[model samples]
Target: MRKLLFEMAYDGSRYHGYQVQQNALSVAEVVQDAVEVVFKKREDIVGCSRTDAGVHASQYFFHMETALQIPPEAAVIALNNCLPGDIAMLSCTEIPPDKAADFHARYSVCWKEYVYKIWNSKVKNPFLQDRAYQVKYPVDAELLDRCAREFIGTHDFRGFCSAGAKPTENYTRTIYRAGVHREGDLIEFRVAGDGFLYNMVRIMVGTLLLAAEGKLKEGDVTRVLASLDREQAGITAPAAGLYLNWVSYTPFGEENPVK
Candidate 1:
């Protein structure tokens, strides 16, 4: 048996989420269908994260164990042919037998990066209808970018997480990068962290939007962080705007530079 790691990108507008569920369509379910077609049997796949519905991914990873022998490059093409247009299989690599025992799609992750896109303008963009959050009000990217710095460093991110999340032993997470920038009318909130609680990135982006709108003043983010009060944080931004941008496996390492 060999363990294969697959890289993919997908538009999540039509799926419930990444995980398979009963009575609902999901990315994993669709991908599994394609995998079954190629391998002539069901091979369970494990994904790196369970992204919320309508949340896209520019880079996602999954691993599966199969007895079939196929070159990694050829597997990519075969899978893509079976997959729908919204999902693209980018690459596949086999894990060495020695390393396969320790490798995991989720547990081995060192960090993940998420980005929230906002289309800030009075005019709605038909092209970005479901790709970005359309904020009619003017947003100050420079100010939000400065305020976003407060998210950097280790902290208990419970305040940024949504209520009713699955109970976890700890809420502490390390943020390596947090910043907001604008290109034309699109504002992007990019955050990188060792791990994130449920809806953490969306909440952070919403808090920054509040800062941009002058509803939250300078230093409010720090206050919210220290308070550890979820009520103190801003609203949870829409799922449509959030995208899993990057994932790193190297221990205590920066992400590889990519376009």
Candidate 2:
């Protein structure tokens, strides 16, 4: 058997999330169904992340074991044909089984990056209404940037994670980089970390928004980080603004830069 890797991108507006559920359609379910149709089997594909409902992905990864002899490029085309318009297969390739393991494998990941988009304008743009967080009140990107800097480095991110997260799991995670920037009317929050808890990015963005809006003091971010309590954070931002931007891995100690 050969391990096949799929690179995919999806618009998450219509799906419940990236994971399959009993009564809901998901990006993973649709992609898995397409793979099943091509391979004539079920549960062959395993996704790298479980993104929340309405959270899009510019790039995502999954692996599967297949006995088929089709070339990787052909697999991409074939899968795209079967997938809905909103989801597309960007590439496909075969890799050693060890290389195909998710983020768990040693020397497998350098970092993971996420981008949260905010539409800061006097009026919401119809085109971006479903893709960005629309805030009528102006946001100071510099202020948000200052707040984001306080979150960089290792910390127990409990204060930034959703209260709905399972209590059994640990909330500590290491953040390598976190920053905020502005482009035209868009305010972007980019964060890179070793791993993140459920709804962690959204909650972080919400807290930063509060800081940008002057509702929360800039120093509050440090207080929240030190608090280690979920209640110390602001509300979770809407899922529509969140995107799984990229996954990075290092093998042979070579850095794989994310675009």
Candidate 3:
């Protein structure tokens, strides 16, 4: 059997999430179906991460082991032909036999970056209806950008994660970068981290929104981190606005920082 790593992007508005579900459509299920069509047999695929409904991914990855001898380039074309329009296959590579055992879609990831988009205007853009969150208020993106820096470091992020997440022993994660940017009426909260807890990025965006509206002061972020209380953080930003911007398996550094 040979192992192959694939990159793809999808519009998650119609699927439950990335993983398979009991009775719901999922990105993985669709990809598996496409795989069966192309390879004439179903193969289990391991995804890099899970994303909630309505969240989109510009670049996502998965890996699978198969006995098929189809070349990687041919497999990409075949998979694309079988996949629906909402999902597109980008690239495919065969893992070297020697290192394939140690490579994993999820575990081998070094970091991931998520961006939450907000349409900050009284009039919501029809084009971004399902693509971005509409906040009918004046959001000070600059102020939130300044406040976002507080999240850059290792910390116990239990307070930012939503309640009822499967009990995890380690809540500590390192944030390499967190900041807000705005262009026209679009506000983006981009965060790159070594790992993330459930709803962590969304809650971080919400907290920044609270800061923009004066509900949470800049200094209060440290207090929230120190308190380790979920109640201290802001609301979970809508999933529609969230996007898995990019993922990196390369060693992070000043020259190749997570973006």
User: Highest TM-score among the candidates is held by which one?
Assistant: 1
Clashing residue pairs for model 2: none
Model 2 spans with C-alpha error above 4 angstroms: 97-110, 251-259
- C-alpha lDDT of candidate 3 relative to the true structure: 0.89
Estimate the TM-score for candidate 1. 0.97
* Better candidate by lDDT, 1 or 2: 1
For model 1, state the Cα shift of residue 43 in Å. 0.5
Candidate 1: 10-residue stretch with minimal lDDT:
250-259
Model 2: residue 135 alpha-carbon error in angstroms: 0.6
lDDT of 2 by residue, 108-159 (tens): 4466789999999988698996699998888999989989988888888878
Candidate 2, poorest ten consecutive residues by summed lDDT:
250-259
lDDT of 2: 0.83
Best by lDDT: 1
Clash count per candidate: 0, 0, 0
In the range 1-259, model 3's lDDT, one tens digit per residue, is 8988999999888888888999999999999999998888988899999999888999999999999999989999999999999899999888889989988989988989998999999995988977899998899888898889899999999999999689899999999998899999999999999999999999998888889889988778878888899888999999989999888877556355221
Candidate 1 residue-wise lDDT, 71-91, digit = tens: 989899999999999999998
